[model samples]
Each structure stands twice: as structure tokens, then as C-alpha cells.
Target chain A: MAPMSDSSAATTLLPPGSLPLDELIACPQCDALFHARMPGRGQRTSCARCHTVLIAPRTNAYLRVIALALTIVILMVAAMFFPFLAVNVQGFTNKASILDTALAFLDGGFMATLAVLVAAFIVLIPLLRAALVIYVLAPLAAGRRPLPGARHMFRLSEDLRPWSMAEIFVIGCAVALVKVSDLARVEFGVAFWMFAALVVVIVFQDGIMCRWTIWKALDDTRNR
Target chain B: MQVDDLESTGRHAEPVTARGAGLVACTRCTRVWPMGETRCARCGSELHSRDWRSLQRVWAWMIVGIVCYIPANIFPMLKTQVLFTHTESTIIEGAIELAQHGSYGIAFVILFASVAIPVGKFVAIGFLAWSVRRPERLHPHHRHRLYEVVEFIGRWSMIDVFVVAILAALVQLNFAASITPGPAAITFALSVIFTMLAAQSFDPRMIWDHDGRGPDNHLTSETP
Candidate 1:
């Protein structure tokens, strides 16, 4: 594929009677086709039929996404090690962090797999995705070409999006807290608030990330 | 890529798709490639105009997910020992216990995420797979929307599993009181993973490529 020009218009020369195939885009959700047009910065192009956001090029979106990703990585690490909650009942008190809970399942049997999965889904996957995002976006944000294997790392990050369960884990923790509130005196720890903030940052990062804009930027710079 | 210029170019009455134009779009990056290209030039991922095996893979994964869901419901999800009073509760029982404690909102969230969403995904994905074979059953727009919802909500089902992990981790006080994950946690996690795979295996493009006047029309007629 030829490098797209800096202008928000198709640059590659079209062959005779070939339908300007280079300028066409198919909606990922409904397969409806549209002539690819870059909306003005801060505007969005959505599929007509399904309303799926097609292209949204925000000013400095890359920098913001990278910043949020870095925050997620920091918060996730802290949440894993720092105490998450403490339960006190009948003069007995015990505190546990996320890592402590996940490892509780490690009894060298079927439960060991659960331990690994809990660690992966809530902590490992989210952290890896954040790191991959930072790795892929940092150079791009600084007006340099993406690092080597940028596309592969970006693809892996997107693939792990659904599997990253840190936000869901926070909601789960809230439910668990309420479930045990009557049984014990539960107090939130430093890590609990950090996790809450981490969830908000993650949501904002995902919202601002326009895949089409990122892919176009990557392709344009790589070809140069 | 100029929006104003594209608006002046006029629009087609019927929706056109990449497959109908003898092209393919990368599922990950949405970059278009000619039908003859086996891999995306930009992303280096395989390109297929239509994955003919999509439905088959969906069915296989969905069946396994359903089988695992059965065991997930029957087995206990959490085991609690409170000063020699042992209690084992399945997923529904846990939710009910929460509701009985007047934590109605949290209970609803748990029940909705753990039960309603998973069952809804199975039904929605099954309908999408069945409808693709006989496309006239439902409108393509609605089917595509259903697919989007299924893909979006599949991850939230992990909330219950995370709650179990957090509870098992936090509620430990030696012989006084403790909570541990039961046999159901792993089966439930597997079910969610399998169903997610089933959802991902489905190609939303198939919703628009109806029978008879389908994707092969342009290729067979060669009328360009």
C-alpha cells in the first residue's frame, strides 16, 4: 500500500475503472461501504447503518492514550502488592491484597489453574495491554516512526482488550465487600482507591482511542 | 479523505460491501486489500473474503461453553467456614444471599452480569449463526446490532469470578472464619472464555451478505 499523504484526502493514484478501491472503507460491523473521508479534527465519521464509529481523529489523542496507559500500569502494580482490604470480625483481623487472594487458589491441583487465571485475567492481561499500548504509541506520539514490531504489539493489545478484566474486577470487589459487610467489618485500603482510579483511567483511554486514526498514522509513517 | 469533497461526489442508493467488490478488509485494522492478496499489506494478517468455516467454529465453541455452564451452575462457587459453621453456595445462591441481606442493587448486578448476560450471549450468538444460513429471518441491521452487544457484554460475565477470587482472598482468619473458592469457579471461567471465542469467531460481514444475490455476484458476472 502506498503511504497516505498528510492531507485528509486520498493520495494514491487510481487505475482506470477500478472504482477508487484505495479510498473505500467497509463498515466492520454491518459491511456497509463508504468512501473513506477524514472528518475534521474532533469530528467523527460513523457508519450510517449501524452507527459504529468509523474514524475519529482527535488532536493529540495519542499522547493522552499513552498517558492513561502508563497510569494503568503503575496503578495495577501497586494494587497487586499493596493491601486491598481488611476484614475484622470477633476480634480476628486479616488483610489481603489482590495477589494474596489470587494465590490462595494455588494448592498444586485444579485450583492452581484458577490461581493462574485470576492473576492473568485481572492483573497480568491488563498490565500487558497497557505496556503494549505504551510501547506502540510512545514513539508515534513524539512524531517519530513507531518502534520495531509496532503493528504486532498493537494488534496483541487490541486482541487482549476483552480479556483485560481490571475494571470488572473492581466491580467484583465492590460486590464481594457488600456480600461480607454483615459478616465482618470491611475497610478499604490504599490499593482499593487506586484500583478505582485505574478503572476510570482505563475507560477514558479506551474511549479516546480511535483505531482507524491510529492505523492510518502508523501506515503513513511506516511507509516513509 | 476530504469530507466536503466526498459529499459532492454523490452517494449510492444501495449499500456496497468489500466482498461484493472483490476486496477484503483486515478484521483488526480495517485496512482494505484486493481479494487476491492473502495478507494485509499494512497489518500482515491473513485476508479472507469470507471465512466459510465461521459458523462451524461458532457452533463448536458455543457447545463447549454451554456444557461448561451446566457444571458451573451445579457445583458450589464459594465455600465459607465461619467458626466451624461450614456453608457452600452456588452462583445463584450467592446472589440470593446478597439479596436477602438487602444489598438488592449489588445482587442484581451480580445476577445480571453472571446469569442474564451469559445466557443472552448464547441465545444471541446462536440466532446470529442460524440466521446467517437463512438470511431472511431478521433484518441485517438488527442482527449486526445484536452481534455488537454480544461482543461488548461478554467480558462483564467475569465479574462474578473476580468476586469469588476477591472474597476468597480477603476473608481469611484462620480457625475463626475463612472463605475459599469452590469447584465451580474454574468451570465458570472456562464457560465465559469459550463463549467469548464463539462470539469472536463469527464474522459480522456475513450479516450483510445474504443468499442468492450475495458476495459472489460481482465475481461471477464480471460486469465492472
Candidate 2:
């Protein structure tokens, strides 16, 4: 997913005195080991071995990240409770929200498990991720020190990244909708747009937030 | 392992890391300072980047994903009702239905996203996990590339779920026609979530861990 990084130029050179192995960060992609150095606020450094972005802290990234996370939290709630789609076919009409669709499977035993899983994938994990991001980044955004276990919280958020499937759900829905449009009277609800917007915001948040920058901020604040 | 080993002694048997090079590079930022540097001078980040237990997590998640995939295929992905008639279709059945109706492209998209990719990932991750230790003549870099490619495509398999969400939202024809997600949707989503987790858990760096100590590490061999 991290296809961005420019390492065209030569890496810095200066192999100095003995340092503990813990001080070195090896390139996960290419195993290129270079000394760690922070770039200026506007500048970024990429791994010389793989050219993966190492550190590029944008000025307002914390604030922007918090904002996007909050938005997703709100979107997930609305997506769950609100009516998702309604269709009318020759004097007959049926409508269901995301929650209702999930609950519809509850009539069966094992299906109930599926229902719970769907609800979790479509709603819970994303909500949890968004909430975690806000909790970890909000203090930094407000110029206050990160709360206790902020490092753990941020790592949790990052680890949860791939498991949060809202955007994928949205895109899958779009493709499915294309196929369904030919069969019925399709009507996208407000919740659908909410989800659609959530995808863009989440992607933007991921792009803007630098893990190194955030970790550095947390560590600095804690050490202070 | 030393660049000097190759130049000064004509011996490049060991990896650059194995040479006891007192240098560590920041994977995030290619800043090279002394080995004792605790943080990246440019990015203010902790220099440690090795994921010590990557394989264990990858295998765990892969098993979980495979387990969840069981119900995903057995249950209906969606239920379609048309003028007092109801029809439920599992993902494969739905795709076949679309193919029957000449929506071959959409059907293929669904099939590939829902079936092929998830199963492919299961195999791919297993392969990568196995091949990392067993020194294959296949270019090690190509294995690394495979891991990257899998990581990049992880979210794409969710297209089937996305399609369901979209159709569920859009295809509502009151009493006449409607499409609702079935039990399989959630299981499918879970499988995807687990697969993604498995993929993320895989350490791409392990692709470079060939025991062969082949010189091919520097020169990428043709993909076998």
C-alpha cells in the first residue's frame, strides 16, 4: 500500500563508532541499513535501500488526522442505523438499513454468527480504528502531551489498519451496485454517501499521517 | 557481508548485515549517522525496525482466514426478491447467474475478487512463508516483490462485499424487487479481514532471508 518514496540519490555516508543494534532501523523491504536522521518539517527522507518514506512530518498532519478519524466514527454510526437502500418494483416496496440487513440473517443459528461478523467488519473494526486514532492523536493535535499508553494506542491503530475494511466495503458495494442496477430500481441512501466519503477521508488520513513523526512526537512528549 | 569484503578480499560470502558492520540505517529515513545514534537525526524516530516474530503472526492469521472462509462459500451472499418470488444466491452462484445473463464482465470481477484473490493469498502467503527459509533459486527479490504485490492487492478482494453494500442500498423496489445481503456476506468479509491481517503480518524482509548465501542477493536473477 505504501508505494510512495523517492530514493534516487545516494544515501548518507559516515560509519562511526559502535552502537547498539537497537539504534538501527533496517529497511523492511530491502534490508538497507542506514543511520537514522530526521528531515525538516516540510522535507521527507526515504530509505536509500528501498526509497520508502522514512520521515516527513507535515505541519498540520495531527489535526487533519484527528478530523478524518472523527468523521469516520460518525459515518460508521450513521451507516449502521440509517436506511441504506430502498427499492420499488411494480407497486411493491422494500427497504433496509445496514443493520437490518445484517440482522436479517439472525433467524438461522450459524447465520447469526455471520451477521455478527458482517456487522463487525462493516462497522465495529472501523469505528474502533477511528476512535483509536482520535484518542492517540487528539492530545498531540491539541498541543498537550499524549495520554498514558499513547504508543500502544498508536501501534494498535497502525496494526488495525489492514483489518479496517470500510473503504473496501464501499468500493465492493459500488461494483455490486453496478450489477444490481440493471435488475432493480436502485436508490442510494444518505448512509451510502456517508460511507463513500468515509473511504476518501480515511485514505487521505493514511496518506498524510507519518508513523515516524507521530511516534517521535509521542516519545518526545513522554520524555519531557 | 562487507562491501570492503568484496573489494579488498574478493570474498562476498556473507550478507552485509553478517559482516558485523557497525552501521544501522533508518528504514523510514535514509539517514546515516554513527552506529550509536539512538534516534534518526533528521526525523526524531527510534531506529529499531526489525519485526522479530513476523512468521508466527503470519501463519496464525492465515489459519484464521482459511477457517473463516468456510462459511463464506456455503451461505448466500445475497437474496433477491422479485414480485413475490425470492431467490438467494451464494457468491459463486450469483456470479454464475450474472454470467447466465450476459454480465460476464461483472461476474468475472465478482468471481476474481471474491474467490480467486482470497484463495490465491492463502497459497501465496503459505508459499512465501515456506520459501523464505528453504533457499530457492528463484530470485529472492522476486519473492520480496510477490509479498509487496500481495500487500498492495489485499483490499481489492473486498469488491464482493462492496458490491453487496451498494446493491443493498440501491436496489430497492418496494415489494417488487429488492436485494438484501445474506449470511455469507459477513463470513466473506471476515475471510477478507483475516487474509488481510495474514498478509500484513508477513514480513517482507524475510524474503531476503535465503539460507543459500547466494551472491544473487546483489544481482536479481530472472524470475524462475
Candidate 3:
């Protein structure tokens, strides 16, 4: 490479494209120069040295987004209404749903800011992002133009994607379980299973599906 | 000339002649070389070398770790217990519990660092890798941004692990309560570490491969 430049730095920030058979590029992480042989569009590739994953080109973008959207909706419903865990102690038993847990915190007199942040980031953000992705993808898949607010929705989803925090919730649960082990009994609940499934779906969709197809569709749309 | 020499021999010698010459220095050895030669006569080492590229294996591991991440989050990571009673909680339940208990700040922190950031990272890395595999030149801006995002967020995934560690250390009440890590802790930690490694291993140079020009030229020409 000639030398680092301001414009090049800016250009580097964009996402990868969906074209096939590209030359190998340097590792963004280490600045190590190398070549990669493209297998096909949307196919996953790996860095030879550090083994970082590279995604393949976009093909069939709309279908993937729709499926993910549906999955997100189902998981969100399950997470909200279902019992997340059951606790039993000294012959007394209790089960808590996601909403119930949030209410419990409110009952405990937590600050309003904390409560809102937790609800929005942990529950609302992920759901909204998933929904937005679906919304954007559905029209694109049908070969029709997105609605007037589609761009804004997509932007919102992108922004929210960073703030959604589900894994932290899992960690808290583990800590609570451990601390409470001597005092009471604990049981798995439907909400817990549903939540786990939700996380899985989110990861899969964000990591593989959305990045590949949705982006390609967006690029094509932008070009058109 | 013979008559002049004989006359000079009796008196003085002819004036001596003097000449000037150019000197060359070897970049490696600092030794002088003939004025016309290109190669270093002594060391024979090349004057330049390219930057190191990230290995493809790192990306492969990232892809594998991402795949495993799906199951890690999906499956019941830890089974909780109290007084011989057991319960299972996923990441979502933990957040809800925190929210319910008025520990919304902690809950949101954990949620963002562990859940949202990691998932976002996976998607970003996957997209970059996929783009690298394509022949089409990616938008230079997006590629750079993806690199920064991946690197910046990779460390946040440790929020869950940190929370676990903090709780395990802090929640030690003999006979009243005790906190113990579950099987999922190890898996979760591994997933985070693996994804981080994957981010570290990605070669950003792959972004420029589509331009079909040397990185040096791109860098120089693109400079503002």
C-alpha cells in the first residue's frame, strides 16, 4: 500500500460487499498484508493468521430477513409473558416472568432511570431491531420499494443494535442463583428457555443472516 | 620528451596528476559500493518488506466460535439451586430480575456489554469477512468502520464474566447464601474470548483487494 490517508481511513469504515472472486486483502486487525481467494458470494471466509471470519456475498436477502423477523417476534412474546424461572424455598414456591421480574425491581424502589434503561436496552431494543430488520427485508424481498420510513427504521435498528444487552442479564441470573443457593430452591421456567432461544436467534440473525443479505439488498437499492 | 626528462632529472620532477571519484553507501551495511551498482554487494538483503497480514485461521476460529455462540446462548447455560431445589435461567431472565430488583443500572450495564455488544461484534466481523470474499470493491468507509466497531466492542463481551466474578467473590455469606459458577460460565467465557480473538485476527487489507491496485497506491492516492 502507498501510505495511510484520511480518506482511506474513512472508506475503511464501510461494510464488505457481496461480489464473488475478490483478491485477498490485508487483515484490518493487525495491518498484516495478505491475499484471500473468494469461494462465492455470501460464503464465509477466514483470516489465515488470526482466523477472523469473513462473510460471503448476499444472495436471497429477503427470505433470510423475514425468517429472522418472525423468530424475533415469537421470542419477544415468549420472553415478555412467560415465566422465566421458578424459585422454591422452605416449601414456598414462586415463578417470575420477564415483566414480573421488571416489576419486582420497580417494587424494590429502583431509580426510574435504571428501570427504563434496563427495560429499553434488555427487552425493547433487541425486539425493535429484529422487527425493523424484518420490516425492511419484507418489502425488499418482494421486489417492491420500502415504505417512506424504511430508511429511518433501518437506521434506528442499527443504532439500537449496539445498546441491546441480553448476555448481561444471563450473568446476573447466574450470580443470583449462586448467592441464593443456600437460602432457597430454584427451577427452570418456560421464559428462561424462550429467552435463551431468543438470544440464539438474535446472534444468528445478526452475525450471519442480516449482515449478508440485508446489506446486499440495501446496496442494490441504493444503486438503483 | 627524452630530452625534457633528462633536463628535469637534473633539476625537478614533472608535476604529479590527481583524480576525483564518487562514493556510494550500502543501506544495510553502510559500506561503500561502486558508483554504478544497484544491489548491495555485501549483505544481499532486500531494502523493504511488507506489513504482516492476519492469518485466515483466525477468521475460521471466529466463524466456529460464532457458530458455537449460537448454542451457548440458546442452551440453558446454568442451572440454579437453593436448598436442594434447582432452576435454570437464560441471559434474559437475569436482566429482568435485576430490573425487578431495582438494580437496573447494573442490569443494563451487563446487558449491553455482554449481550448486545458481542452479538453486534459477531455480525460486524461476519460481514467484513464476507465482503473480503467478494470481488466487488467494498465502500472503503464501511470497511473501516466495521474494523473499528469489531475491535472496540470485542472486549465488552466480558461483562458477563466480570459480573460472574464479582458476584462470586462478593456474595459469600456462610450458611445464609453462597454463589457458585455454573457450567455455562466456562462456555460463555470461551465464547467471548474466541470472538475477541477472531476480531484480532481479521485482516483489514482484504477491504482493498477488490480495487485491483496495490495498497501503497491506494493509500497515497486516497490521501487528502
Best by TM-score: 1
Q: Compare candidates 2 and 3 on DockQ and give the better one.
A: 2
| Off by more than 4 A, model 3 | A1-42, A45-55, A58-61, A107-110, A210-213, B1-224
Clashes of 1: 2
List DockQ, one per candidate, in order.
0.49, 0.28, 0.04
The TM-score of the first chain in every model comes to: 0.88, 0.84, 0.72
Q: Say which docking band candidate 3 falls in.
A: incorrect
Ranked candidates (lDDT, high to low): 1, 2, 3
Task: Score chain A of model 1 by TM-score against the reference chain A.
Answer: 0.88
Could you give the candidate ranking by TM-score, starting with the highest? 1, 2, 3
lDDT of 2 by residue, B85-172 (tens): 9999998999998898888887888888888898889988998876655546456646666787788787788777657755664565
- As for candidate 1, its clashing pairs are A9-B1, A10-B1
Alpha-carbon error at A55 in model 1, in Å? 0.4
Worst 10 residues of 1 chain A by lDDT: A7-16
True lDDT of residue A7, candidate 2? 22
lDDT of 1 by residue, B1-224 (tens): 45444433313234456666667778777777778888887777788778868889999999999999998999999999988899999999999988898999998998998899999999999999876766656766668778988998898999988888888888888988889889899899999999999999998877766322223433334322
